[model samples]
Target: MDYTALTEAISSKSYEKIAEMCDDLMLQGSTEGVVNNEDWPYAIHLLGHIYVDDINSARFVWKNVPRVVKENRPEVTAAWKIGQRLWTRDYAGVYEAIREFNGSPEAQSLVDSFSEVYTKRMFQLLRSAYSTISIQETALFLGMNEEDATKYVLQQGWSVDPASTMFTVKKQAIVTEQKLDPSKLQRLTEYVFHLEH
Candidate 1:
């Protein structure tokens, strides 16, 4: 398989697309015979799944990867480590794994993207779950130092209490308008018309 497009996707940091392509390859049974090597991009594919926070899919990919690839490529192993931490909900361990990764620049970029996405997700979860939370816990969740976490929260409109060292999260109420599917409505109308006739 020509991996030119996959390389371009990695260069552009299109991780979701990478995940889709990897899925399509597996679905087509194209990767079954392919040898794992520098060109196969198994690491990128594995990291792509992890990047999307799809731990189960990531595990699936890891299980199918050739043992030689897993043994030879530290980057691939590191990516799996991150996935393992995610699966166990060890949020701090996730950051530690990323910090310890000394992989190629391409894999490094994906790891960094995953870190940012995970941090944002945790922040959203925290905001929804807490009216006020300790700064220390916020830092742990965000994988940042206390001062940096404080600054990040403040920038997000969370107020800080100097005396208690707590942050008051400003949760925005999300208003979702219901959308109607025209095709579904049309199908229902046609069924009703046939029933009446």
Candidate 2:
């Protein structure tokens, strides 16, 4: 069946276009009562997750539908409709759906792999840019409040002024005076040096 050709076609298309393609493919496959290939179902599930992430934008392309309606059926169309509504820039909705989806047996089976890829990409970005970040900037980047950021920096053995409430560049003595495990100390030293230079 020329899977590469289909993949290229899907990749070249916009998200809505891809969703439409998946729906059509799934419906056609269902009519035959057999989807011999696993890719279509996975693609459909992915489309659902994407849709749920950005409902308004997704709805601009695909319309509003009931969430329960979307969830009841495991069909690609239903999943796509739900995904269209679920995945969004709205952090609250996204977070809730992530919790809900990850709790589901079907989603759990896929989420570990999905999250591994996501974490790797996030860490790559963090490692590339984090060292250049100032304390305030790092706080904002990490979505932490100023107090939390200050506490975190101090916890890492950096001096922070209590009165001025600023993170100082000077290294501070460890509060506990306990030696770090050798391997961990080496890693910490490497990280500190990387950040310093």
Candidate 3:
């Protein structure tokens, strides 16, 4: 099969589109030709799944990929390392895995996209999981240096203590009450009453 579409998707950095194409390719069969071909750009497909935080799908791709491909393509293995880190929820290891990836220039954008998505995810997790955490820990979670992490937290309206270098995470208050449409509620209530009667 021609790889024109896949190549175009990679060059355009359309990770979502690439992922869809990969899914289609996998559905066709074992992906023997596509996965093993030197020109296949399979690294982008794997990294694109990671970029979208689809760990299970990423694992499927990794499993289907031939051992020879994994051994020969360091970039493909590096991408899987990131997937493994994510699967285990090893937040620190995610950064390490990303740092280890020295993929060709084409795959760098997908890796960078994954880093951005993961950093945002970690920020949300930190806000929900910790009332107060050290700036050092936050830095690790964010894959940023301490100074930059501190600056980022401050920008997010979180308070920081200079002496201890601990940051108080600004948690968004959860609004428990959901607004219901009065007309719909009345209709549902009437229906319930009728059913009961």
Candidate 4:
């Protein structure tokens, strides 16, 4: 039995190496080694994490991985769920998952690494919630000093208020069409074939 591609690696539970192999193989643009293997679920799970910060890449892999691979693979499913929330910038969910994994000594290092992303995502949420909020408040909230928080916000593409140390979020206007009832629609032009005057 040939166990070269993913199964043997997965059976060994050497996920970090599997992730590295997936990267090296993906760079070659030849998926002959990874796809259609019995361990497709595990491979996809590893691939998604390899591009954890890249939401589009993670989703693209998920789409390509197909629905059939998700069956009976709880770990793969959980990994996909994590990638999805990470992609959607769901910091709460991400942090929860990180905390859940933190209990395992083996996974602690990986959890710590993922926590960095959670920290980044928390700030993103903060930036999103406030259209214009005091930088000092942000600094206080994130436990950073004024200057560092200001620099961080600015680096994240938020504008600083000239009058004070405030982070001003520039949100795009949302335009939506009002729904009109069909019965209430006004007919501006109508041709009368036969009208009783």
Candidate 5:
């Protein structure tokens, strides 16, 4: 297994090739229940990029990766570290992981391509916690200037006032069933007796 082609595919930022190589390596590692040690690193090295492209698929892959395999492969462990950082919204830790992987050509390639992906994902994550955000905060999170952030929010149809620097995201209204009043339920016992007849 040369693995040079896989490295080249990552370095070139060929998404299709990267996916194929990940699949191929995974298959090779598990074939006949005899795993090749090298395939673990080669496949684990691409997880960050995979996460950027398809988070659900990345989660599926992460879940399937055996704990034993992750412990034995540095790249697998490194990817796990990144996943932990991502789960906790630790941006600094994520960047640190990228830096840590810089020595590995394939992992570094994935890290370099993930800059845009990370920013978009950060916004998605923030929306779950914040229904409204100020222009300055959005700018800081998105790595853009305040004016641009304001313009972007306005373009996205966020509720904004010209005089104010904050915008509000319109979240879906939650609906709940009205609670029953025990005092109003006068005689459910009578109804039960009639049903028995």
Candidate 6:
């Protein structure tokens, strides 16, 4: 099956359609161990994550959640809010919300599910950054030279792209201009490499 195509279709679909698709897939036993399956459930979780981050999208998803998953609806909405705040770098606020949610038995499952989905995303990003094999290619993509690319990677201590192996000259230039620190680059490279094997 063309997973990329499938994911793209899912990503662009309406919240109602996505909910229906999820339900259909689940009925087909396609969601068994979804939390553990990196591709299927992970992709669905990503859709939910995107919805949570995008306000309009989240509302759509919330409106469409099937009755079977209705009990877990609020938690899903909460997860989206938590994720958006977290993505905006509001670590303190995110933590506080997480703490409050964690305290609630009703919210624990959803929170845990969000954590797993988020972790998987991080790993995927790390993998993308590490898989970049050529300094020139990386540099060009970031709009930097080899030296700057190395410096940025070493300094940023985080992976810029963790989903794909390809990087272009323009992207390299962007990375270089961003002036990623050497230490950060090293950390990101190390983390990404560790995942490669």
Question: Which candidate leads the pack in lDDT?
Answer: 1
In candidate 2, which residue ranges exceed 4 Å CA deviation?
Answer: 1-44, 47-68, 71-96, 102-104, 133-197
| Tens digits of per-residue lDDT for model 4, 125-147 | 67568788897777755446789
Worst window of 10 by summed lDDT in candidate 2: 89-98
Scored against the true structure, residue 26 in model 6 reaches a CA lDDT of 46
lDDT of 2 by residue, 67-131 (tens): 44335444434334335433433323333343345333433433433333433343344445444
Models 1 onward score TM values of 0.83, 0.33, 0.81, 0.43, 0.51, 0.28
Poorly placed runs, candidate 6 (over 4 Å): 1-56, 59-80, 86-106, 130-197
Better of 1 and 5 by TM-score: 1
lDDT score at residue 114, model 6, on the 0-100 scale: 48
lDDT of 5: 0.63
lDDT of 6 at 85: 60
Stronger candidate by lDDT (3 vs 6): 3
Task: Give model 1's TM-score versus the native structure.
Answer: 0.83
The per-candidate count of clashes, in order, stands at 0, 14, 0, 0, 0, 34
Candidate 6 residue-wise lDDT, 11-33, digit = tens: 45433244344445544544454
Model 5 CA lDDT for position 131:
84
lDDT of each: 0.85, 0.45, 0.83, 0.57, 0.63, 0.47
Clashing pairs in 4: none
Indicate whether candidate 2 or candidate 3 has the larger lDDT. 3
lDDT of 3 at 121: 89
- lDDT score of model 2? 0.45
